[model samples]
Target: MRNQILGRQGEQVAVEFLQRQGYGICARNFRVPVGEIDIIARKGDVLAFVEVKTRHGNRYGTPAQAVNFHKQKKIIQTAQWFLRQKCLSEDKCFCRFDVVEVYALPEGKWQVHHLPGAFEC
Candidate 1:
Protein backbone atom coordinates (compact mmCIF):
# COMPACT_ATOMS: atom_id res chain seq x y z
CA MET A 1 0.00 0.00 0.00
CA ARG A 2 2.78 2.42 0.81
CA ASN A 3 4.48 1.65 -2.47
CA GLN A 4 1.26 2.29 -4.34
CA ILE A 5 0.98 5.71 -2.76
CA LEU A 6 4.54 6.54 -3.66
CA GLY A 7 3.99 5.36 -7.22
CA ARG A 8 0.93 7.52 -7.68
CA GLN A 9 2.74 10.50 -6.23
CA GLY A 10 5.58 9.94 -8.63
CA GLU A 11 3.20 9.72 -11.55
CA GLN A 12 1.64 13.01 -10.53
CA VAL A 13 5.04 14.61 -10.55
CA ALA A 14 5.70 13.19 -14.01
CA VAL A 15 2.42 14.59 -15.31
CA GLU A 16 3.22 18.02 -13.97
CA PHE A 17 6.69 17.90 -15.45
CA LEU A 18 5.31 17.04 -18.86
CA GLN A 19 2.77 19.83 -18.65
CA ARG A 20 5.47 22.34 -17.83
CA GLN A 21 7.40 21.16 -20.86
CA GLY A 22 4.50 22.16 -23.14
CA TYR A 23 2.86 18.77 -23.45
CA GLY A 24 -0.89 18.87 -23.20
CA ILE A 25 -1.99 16.16 -20.81
CA CYS A 26 -4.63 14.00 -22.41
CA ALA A 27 -5.07 11.36 -19.73
CA ARG A 28 -3.62 9.78 -16.64
CA ASN A 29 -3.76 6.13 -15.64
CA PHE A 30 -5.51 5.27 -18.86
CA ARG A 31 -6.67 1.69 -18.64
CA VAL A 32 -7.36 -0.78 -21.38
CA PRO A 33 -7.94 -4.52 -21.39
CA VAL A 34 -4.25 -5.07 -21.99
CA GLY A 35 -2.55 -2.57 -19.66
CA GLU A 36 -2.51 0.99 -18.36
CA ILE A 37 -0.72 4.07 -19.60
CA ASP A 38 0.71 6.23 -16.86
CA ILE A 39 0.41 9.50 -18.70
CA ILE A 40 -0.82 10.52 -22.14
CA ALA A 41 0.06 13.86 -23.63
CA ARG A 42 0.17 15.65 -26.93
CA LYS A 43 2.91 17.80 -28.37
CA GLY A 44 1.97 19.39 -31.66
CA ASP A 45 0.63 16.60 -33.88
CA VAL A 46 2.12 13.76 -31.93
CA LEU A 47 0.48 11.79 -29.17
CA ALA A 48 2.85 10.56 -26.51
CA PHE A 49 2.05 7.56 -24.36
CA VAL A 50 4.35 7.68 -21.38
CA GLU A 51 5.40 5.00 -18.96
CA VAL A 52 6.70 6.28 -15.66
CA LYS A 53 9.03 4.26 -13.50
CA THR A 54 10.11 5.46 -10.08
CA ARG A 55 12.67 4.02 -7.74
CA HIS A 56 14.42 4.98 -4.52
CA GLY A 57 17.84 4.10 -5.86
CA ASN A 58 19.72 2.39 -8.62
CA ARG A 59 20.61 -0.66 -6.62
CA TYR A 60 18.69 -2.82 -9.06
CA GLY A 61 18.89 -0.89 -12.30
CA THR A 62 17.99 2.37 -13.95
CA PRO A 63 14.26 3.10 -14.16
CA ALA A 64 14.17 3.04 -17.94
CA GLN A 65 15.85 -0.36 -17.98
CA ALA A 66 12.80 -1.84 -16.38
CA VAL A 67 10.84 -1.34 -19.57
CA ASN A 68 11.95 -4.30 -21.58
CA PHE A 69 10.73 -5.58 -24.90
CA HIS A 70 7.77 -7.49 -23.47
CA LYS A 71 6.68 -4.42 -21.56
CA GLN A 72 6.99 -2.28 -24.66
CA LYS A 73 4.76 -4.68 -26.57
CA LYS A 74 2.12 -4.45 -23.86
CA ILE A 75 2.25 -0.67 -23.90
CA ILE A 76 1.87 -0.59 -27.64
CA GLN A 77 -1.11 -2.91 -27.53
CA THR A 78 -2.74 -0.74 -24.89
CA ALA A 79 -2.09 2.38 -26.89
CA GLN A 80 -3.72 0.81 -29.90
CA TRP A 81 -6.78 -0.03 -27.88
CA PHE A 82 -6.92 3.51 -26.56
CA LEU A 83 -6.80 5.01 -30.02
CA ARG A 84 -9.42 2.66 -31.38
CA GLN A 85 -11.76 3.37 -28.51
CA LYS A 86 -11.33 7.10 -28.97
CA CYS A 87 -12.15 6.72 -32.68
CA LEU A 88 -8.88 8.30 -33.61
CA SER A 89 -7.17 7.15 -36.76
CA GLU A 90 -3.59 6.10 -36.28
CA ASP A 91 -2.53 7.80 -39.48
CA LYS A 92 -4.20 11.07 -38.60
CA CYS A 93 -1.86 11.75 -35.75
CA PHE A 94 1.65 10.70 -34.93
CA CYS A 95 2.12 8.32 -32.00
CA ARG A 96 5.16 7.75 -29.90
CA PHE A 97 6.13 6.03 -26.71
CA ASP A 98 8.03 7.75 -23.92
CA VAL A 99 9.47 6.79 -20.59
CA VAL A 100 9.79 9.03 -17.54
CA GLU A 101 12.23 8.15 -14.81
CA VAL A 102 11.76 9.50 -11.33
CA TYR A 103 14.26 9.02 -8.57
CA ALA A 104 13.18 9.53 -5.01
CA LEU A 105 15.86 11.47 -3.22
CA PRO A 106 16.77 11.38 0.45
CA GLU A 107 15.38 14.89 0.88
CA GLY A 108 11.88 13.59 -0.01
CA LYS A 109 11.97 15.28 -3.39
CA TRP A 110 12.13 13.59 -6.76
CA GLN A 111 14.42 13.98 -9.73
CA VAL A 112 12.46 13.62 -12.97
CA HIS A 113 13.86 12.78 -16.36
CA HIS A 114 11.67 12.68 -19.42
CA LEU A 115 12.82 10.67 -22.37
CA PRO A 116 10.70 11.62 -25.31
CA GLY A 117 10.38 9.17 -28.18
CA ALA A 118 12.20 6.72 -26.01
CA PHE A 119 11.04 3.63 -27.81
CA GLU A 120 9.30 2.47 -30.93
CA CYS A 121 6.31 0.23 -31.39
Candidate 2:
Protein backbone atom coordinates (compact mmCIF):
# COMPACT_ATOMS: atom_id res chain seq x y z
CA MET A 1 0.00 0.00 0.00
CA ARG A 2 2.76 2.39 0.88
CA ASN A 3 4.63 1.51 -2.27
CA GLN A 4 1.56 2.14 -4.35
CA ILE A 5 1.14 5.55 -2.83
CA LEU A 6 4.76 6.33 -3.43
CA GLY A 7 4.44 5.19 -7.04
CA ARG A 8 1.38 7.33 -7.56
CA GLN A 9 3.12 10.34 -6.11
CA GLY A 10 6.09 9.73 -8.34
CA GLU A 11 3.94 9.41 -11.42
CA GLN A 12 2.28 12.70 -10.63
CA VAL A 13 5.63 14.38 -10.31
CA ALA A 14 6.71 12.90 -13.61
CA VAL A 15 3.62 14.27 -15.32
CA GLU A 16 4.29 17.76 -14.07
CA PHE A 17 7.88 17.52 -15.15
CA LEU A 18 6.92 16.32 -18.61
CA GLN A 19 4.40 19.08 -19.00
CA ARG A 20 7.01 21.62 -18.05
CA GLN A 21 9.22 20.16 -20.75
CA GLY A 22 6.47 20.69 -23.33
CA TYR A 23 5.30 17.14 -23.76
CA GLY A 24 1.58 16.91 -24.30
CA ILE A 25 0.19 14.08 -22.25
CA CYS A 26 -2.18 11.77 -24.10
CA ALA A 27 -2.79 9.03 -21.58
CA ARG A 28 -2.00 7.76 -18.16
CA ASN A 29 -2.18 4.15 -16.99
CA PHE A 30 -3.06 2.77 -20.38
CA ARG A 31 -3.83 -0.89 -19.96
CA VAL A 32 -4.44 -3.78 -22.30
CA PRO A 33 -4.65 -7.55 -21.92
CA VAL A 34 -0.91 -7.96 -22.01
CA GLY A 35 0.24 -5.18 -19.73
CA GLU A 36 0.12 -1.48 -18.83
CA ILE A 37 1.87 1.72 -19.83
CA ASP A 38 2.39 4.43 -17.26
CA ILE A 39 2.18 7.41 -19.61
CA ILE A 40 1.77 8.22 -23.29
CA ALA A 41 2.86 11.64 -24.40
CA ARG A 42 3.66 13.51 -27.56
CA LYS A 43 6.52 15.87 -28.04
CA GLY A 44 6.38 17.51 -31.46
CA ASP A 45 5.92 14.72 -34.01
CA VAL A 46 7.19 11.98 -31.74
CA LEU A 47 4.90 9.77 -29.71
CA ALA A 48 6.58 8.59 -26.58
CA PHE A 49 5.61 5.47 -24.67
CA VAL A 50 6.93 6.18 -21.22
CA GLU A 51 7.61 3.91 -18.29
CA VAL A 52 7.75 5.61 -14.93
CA LYS A 53 9.72 4.03 -12.16
CA THR A 54 9.67 5.63 -8.76
CA ARG A 55 11.76 4.72 -5.79
CA HIS A 56 12.32 6.06 -2.36
CA GLY A 57 16.07 6.19 -2.67
CA ASN A 58 19.07 4.99 -4.65
CA ARG A 59 19.84 2.24 -2.22
CA TYR A 60 18.42 -0.33 -4.59
CA GLY A 61 19.34 1.24 -7.89
CA THR A 62 18.41 4.07 -10.15
CA PRO A 63 14.75 3.91 -11.08
CA ALA A 64 15.57 3.63 -14.76
CA GLN A 65 17.71 0.56 -14.05
CA ALA A 66 14.52 -1.35 -13.39
CA VAL A 67 13.56 -1.20 -17.03
CA ASN A 68 15.37 -4.33 -18.05
CA PHE A 69 15.36 -5.95 -21.48
CA HIS A 70 12.27 -8.01 -20.78
CA LYS A 71 10.45 -4.93 -19.59
CA GLN A 72 11.53 -3.11 -22.74
CA LYS A 73 10.11 -5.87 -24.88
CA LYS A 74 6.76 -5.63 -23.10
CA ILE A 75 6.69 -1.86 -23.48
CA ILE A 76 7.45 -2.21 -27.20
CA GLN A 77 4.66 -4.67 -27.61
CA THR A 78 2.24 -2.31 -25.88
CA ALA A 79 3.40 0.63 -27.97
CA GLN A 80 2.75 -1.32 -31.15
CA TRP A 81 -0.73 -2.09 -29.94
CA PHE A 82 -1.30 1.53 -29.08
CA LEU A 83 -0.33 2.66 -32.55
CA ARG A 84 -2.55 0.09 -34.16
CA GLN A 85 -5.49 1.07 -32.01
CA LYS A 86 -5.02 4.73 -32.88
CA CYS A 87 -4.66 3.86 -36.59
CA LEU A 88 -1.46 5.81 -36.67
CA SER A 89 1.61 4.56 -38.39
CA GLU A 90 4.88 4.77 -36.59
CA ASP A 91 6.46 5.87 -39.83
CA LYS A 92 4.24 8.90 -40.01
CA CYS A 93 4.69 9.99 -36.40
CA PHE A 94 7.86 8.50 -35.12
CA CYS A 95 7.62 6.37 -31.96
CA ARG A 96 9.96 6.60 -29.03
CA PHE A 97 10.34 4.68 -25.77
CA ASP A 98 11.16 6.82 -22.80
CA VAL A 99 11.87 6.33 -19.13
CA VAL A 100 10.97 8.70 -16.33
CA GLU A 101 12.75 8.13 -13.09
CA VAL A 102 11.29 9.59 -9.93
CA TYR A 103 13.19 9.59 -6.72
CA ALA A 104 10.92 10.24 -3.77
CA LEU A 105 12.90 12.18 -1.26
CA PRO A 106 11.89 13.01 2.27
CA GLU A 107 9.49 15.89 2.98
CA GLY A 108 7.49 15.23 -0.20
CA LYS A 109 10.27 16.23 -2.54
CA TRP A 110 11.34 14.34 -5.60
CA GLN A 111 14.13 14.22 -8.12
CA VAL A 112 13.16 13.33 -11.65
CA HIS A 113 15.18 12.28 -14.66
CA HIS A 114 13.71 11.95 -18.10
CA LEU A 115 15.28 9.68 -20.65
CA PRO A 116 13.95 10.27 -24.12
CA GLY A 117 14.63 7.84 -26.94
CA ALA A 118 15.75 5.35 -24.37
CA PHE A 119 15.18 2.41 -26.68
CA GLU A 120 13.87 1.49 -30.11
CA CYS A 121 11.45 -1.21 -30.99
Candidate 3:
Protein backbone atom coordinates (compact mmCIF):
# COMPACT_ATOMS: atom_id res chain seq x y z
CA MET A 1 0.00 0.00 0.00
CA ARG A 2 2.74 2.41 0.92
CA ASN A 3 4.62 1.52 -2.20
CA GLN A 4 1.58 2.18 -4.32
CA ILE A 5 1.20 5.61 -2.82
CA LEU A 6 4.80 6.40 -3.42
CA GLY A 7 4.50 5.15 -6.98
CA ARG A 8 1.48 7.34 -7.61
CA GLN A 9 3.26 10.37 -6.26
CA GLY A 10 6.29 9.57 -8.33
CA GLU A 11 4.20 9.27 -11.47
CA GLN A 12 2.78 12.69 -10.89
CA VAL A 13 6.24 14.12 -10.48
CA ALA A 14 7.31 12.39 -13.67
CA VAL A 15 4.39 13.91 -15.49
CA GLU A 16 5.35 17.39 -14.38
CA PHE A 17 8.93 16.77 -15.32
CA LEU A 18 8.00 15.49 -18.76
CA GLN A 19 5.82 18.49 -19.38
CA ARG A 20 8.67 20.75 -18.52
CA GLN A 21 10.76 18.85 -21.03
CA GLY A 22 8.15 19.61 -23.74
CA TYR A 23 6.57 16.16 -23.88
CA GLY A 24 2.82 16.29 -24.10
CA ILE A 25 1.21 13.54 -22.09
CA CYS A 26 -1.08 11.26 -24.06
CA ALA A 27 -2.13 8.66 -21.52
CA ARG A 28 -1.60 7.48 -17.99
CA ASN A 29 -1.78 3.96 -16.62
CA PHE A 30 -2.52 2.42 -19.99
CA ARG A 31 -3.17 -1.25 -19.19
CA VAL A 32 -3.73 -4.21 -21.42
CA PRO A 33 -3.75 -7.97 -21.05
CA VAL A 34 -0.09 -8.21 -21.89
CA GLY A 35 1.21 -5.37 -19.73
CA GLU A 36 0.80 -1.80 -18.58
CA ILE A 37 2.45 1.50 -19.52
CA ASP A 38 2.85 4.04 -16.77
CA ILE A 39 2.65 7.03 -19.06
CA ILE A 40 2.60 7.89 -22.77
CA ALA A 41 3.83 11.17 -24.18
CA ARG A 42 4.33 12.76 -27.54
CA LYS A 43 6.86 15.21 -28.83
CA GLY A 44 6.71 16.21 -32.47
CA ASP A 45 6.45 12.90 -34.36
CA VAL A 46 7.78 10.79 -31.55
CA LEU A 47 5.62 8.73 -29.28
CA ALA A 48 7.20 7.81 -25.97
CA PHE A 49 6.02 4.88 -23.93
CA VAL A 50 7.25 5.61 -20.45
CA GLU A 51 7.76 3.47 -17.39
CA VAL A 52 7.99 5.33 -14.11
CA LYS A 53 9.94 3.97 -11.15
CA THR A 54 10.00 5.70 -7.83
CA ARG A 55 12.09 5.09 -4.74
CA HIS A 56 12.90 6.73 -1.46
CA GLY A 57 16.57 5.89 -1.74
CA ASN A 58 19.05 4.02 -3.90
CA ARG A 59 19.91 1.39 -1.33
CA TYR A 60 18.77 -1.40 -3.64
CA GLY A 61 19.56 0.29 -6.91
CA THR A 62 18.55 3.25 -9.01
CA PRO A 63 14.86 3.24 -9.75
CA ALA A 64 15.54 2.86 -13.46
CA GLN A 65 17.46 -0.34 -12.73
CA ALA A 66 14.20 -2.01 -11.82
CA VAL A 67 13.19 -2.16 -15.47
CA ASN A 68 14.84 -5.36 -16.48
CA PHE A 69 14.64 -7.50 -19.62
CA HIS A 70 11.26 -9.06 -18.83
CA LYS A 71 9.74 -5.70 -18.02
CA GLN A 72 11.13 -4.22 -21.20
CA LYS A 73 9.61 -7.02 -23.26
CA LYS A 74 6.19 -6.42 -21.74
CA ILE A 75 6.39 -2.68 -22.31
CA ILE A 76 7.41 -3.23 -25.89
CA GLN A 77 4.52 -5.59 -26.51
CA THR A 78 2.08 -3.13 -25.03
CA ALA A 79 3.50 -0.28 -27.10
CA GLN A 80 2.97 -2.32 -30.24
CA TRP A 81 -0.63 -2.92 -29.33
CA PHE A 82 -1.10 0.76 -28.58
CA LEU A 83 0.16 1.78 -31.99
CA ARG A 84 -2.17 -0.67 -33.72
CA GLN A 85 -5.12 0.51 -31.69
CA LYS A 86 -4.39 4.13 -32.46
CA CYS A 87 -4.11 3.36 -36.17
CA LEU A 88 -0.73 4.98 -36.28
CA SER A 89 1.82 3.63 -38.66
CA GLU A 90 4.94 2.66 -36.78
CA ASP A 91 7.06 3.56 -39.77
CA LYS A 92 5.84 7.12 -39.96
CA CYS A 93 5.45 7.84 -36.28
CA PHE A 94 8.62 7.05 -34.40
CA CYS A 95 8.29 5.25 -31.10
CA ARG A 96 10.55 5.29 -28.08
CA PHE A 97 10.66 3.70 -24.63
CA ASP A 98 11.52 5.98 -21.76
CA VAL A 99 12.10 5.52 -18.05
CA VAL A 100 11.44 8.29 -15.59
CA GLU A 101 12.99 7.90 -12.18
CA VAL A 102 11.63 9.88 -9.28
CA TYR A 103 13.45 9.89 -5.98
CA ALA A 104 11.67 11.16 -2.94
CA LEU A 105 13.90 13.49 -1.00
CA PRO A 106 13.77 15.25 2.28
CA GLU A 107 11.88 18.51 2.85
CA GLY A 108 9.00 17.25 0.71
CA LYS A 109 11.04 17.62 -2.41
CA TRP A 110 11.67 15.13 -5.17
CA GLN A 111 14.20 14.61 -7.91
CA VAL A 112 13.38 13.46 -11.44
CA HIS A 113 15.60 11.72 -13.91
CA HIS A 114 14.19 11.41 -17.39
CA LEU A 115 15.82 8.85 -19.60
CA PRO A 116 14.58 9.19 -23.12
CA GLY A 117 14.89 6.24 -25.46
CA ALA A 118 15.75 4.14 -22.47
CA PHE A 119 14.84 0.98 -24.35
CA GLU A 120 13.98 -0.15 -27.81
CA CYS A 121 10.80 -1.67 -29.15
Pick the TM-score winner: 3
Residue 87 Cα positional deviation in candidate 3, in Å, after optimal superposition: 0.4
- lDDT of candidate 3 over 35-120, digit per residue (tens): 99999999998999999999999999998899999999999999988888998878988899999999999998999988999988
Which pairs clash (backbone N, Cα, C closer than 3 Å) in model 3? none
User: Which sections of candidate 3 miss by over 4 Å?
Assistant: none
Name the better of 2 and 3 by TM-score.
3
User: Global lDDT for candidate 3?
Assistant: 0.94
List, residue by residue over 1-121, the lDDT tens digit for candidate 1: 9889888989989988998989999999999879999998998999999999988988999999999999999999999998998999789999999999998898788999999888997
**Model 1: residues >4 Å from true position, as ranges?**
none
lDDT (C-alpha, whole model) for all candidates = 0.92, 0.90, 0.94
Q: Per-prediction TM-score, please?
A: 0.96, 0.96, 0.97
User: How well does candidate 3 match the true structure, expressed as C-alpha RMSD?
Assistant: 0.7
* 1-121 per-residue lDDT for model 2 (tens digits): 9989988988899999999999999999998877789999998998899999999877888888899999999898888888889999878998899999998778878899899988777
The full ranking of all candidates by lDDT, starting with the best, is: 3, 1, 2
Query: How close to the true structure is residue 29 of candidate 3, measured as C-alpha lDDT?
Result: 96
Work out candidate 2's RMSD over C-alphas. 0.8
For model 1 the local lDDT of residue 53 reads 95
